[model samples]
Target: MEEMECGIEKKAAAMAAAEEVGRKEEAAAGDVGLKELSRKLNDFAKARDWEQYHSPRNLLLAMIAEVGELSELFMWKGEVRKGLADWDEAEKEHLGEELADVLLYLVRLSDICGVDLGDAATRKIVKNAAKYPAPSKEGA
Candidate 1:
């Protein structure tokens, strides 16, 4: 879990730095081009001395850990976390950082496996909408 959380932070720092340099001209290359993204992921890991720590097994475990951390924000508290009620500025910032952590590991995992997350997510949303379309409020 710690490993995964660390990886996410690491990736985000690199991405933010890249943005500062005007490297990413656009949001990911859309549906067809992820080659460069994967390469960047690989290079980022290598440069940080993290490649040795990121086997498929470790990466998978880390991804799950990151998810667990995200869940911890509300696993039992339910919607309290989402409500942002009673949360101080620090807590809000912490929450934002943790959520970003989950997203980072997710994107990294997809890159490692040569998967296109944006496309995959869009496809899943379409399938899910078909399977479970909006409930009819009129039925009430």
Candidate 2:
């Protein structure tokens, strides 16, 4: 079953990669939402038959690893802004790749767990706004 799943995932990923070439046009035109990206990633995995390895735990670990790589880019840099500003094109590209990896794993994990990330994010934002309200005119 595991082998079968891996095969499926590989096929899915290949198909997704091919489709990604075409998707570049859409991506260039406008931003894609988390749900859209999630669907694309799920389709990618389904095609390759790799869902057997997309358990939440594994995905979480993969996300953590990607974060670690992203963090490494900032190591020795005093501040995030300075680090980003100082990076050349290659470094920035590397940073972007790591970030993309983290997002991909996160989206995959959320999809498998049946979480609606957009709704969850909206609720969190509303909760945060209530938790930290703007200062009143009198206070200011």
Candidate 3:
């Protein structure tokens, strides 16, 4: 069944990517929430007749495979950390590109399932704010 349509702007996506994460309370750029990204994903899959193949089970596998490809960037089993931490200037850049491959699949998958990662993260933060109640040095 076709899900409810959400208007996610590309400009919003760019803005969110550009915005600083540690800044003060903001409107949350990248208005293109999970639902929006999913819609885009749907289009991509449909064009290639791939949606029929994207069962919940298979989607999980695809995600895993892409993740493994990403992991190849740092599978030295040596002193290196999980990512490009050990590499010099040139290799680190190569690792960065590999990381993008992993993220692209994740984004596509999230888009297919209507997962607005940013919105979801924000909502979770709000929930945590109420539950955790951070220790304030001085009462406001």
Best by lDDT: 2
Best-fitting candidate, measured by TM-score?
Answer: 2
Worst 10 residues of 2 by lDDT: 24-33
Query: What does the lDDT come to for candidate 3?
Result: 0.67
lDDT of 1 by residue, 1-140 (tens): 99999999999999999886664444443442445556666788889989888766778898788888777765666457446876788877877878766766666778767678878988999999999999889979
Regions of model 2 farther than 4 Å from truth: 1-23, 26-30
- Estimated TM-score per prediction? 0.60, 0.77, 0.51
Q: 79-109 in candidate 3: lDDT tens per residue?
A: 6766545578887877666765566567775
- lDDT by residue (5-105, candidate 2, tens digit) is 99999999999998998788556635778988898898998999988998999999989999999899888877677557777999899987898898888
Give candidate 1 regions above 4 Å deviation. 1-41, 75-82, 135-140
- In model 3, residue pairs whose N, Cα or C atoms come closer than 3 Å (at least 3 residues apart or on different chains), thus clashing, are 12-30, 34-115, 34-116, 37-111, 38-111
Measured by TM-score, how close is model 1 to the native structure?
0.60
Kindly report which residue stretches of model 3 are placed more than 4 angstroms away from their true locations once superposed: 1-40, 77-90, 131-133
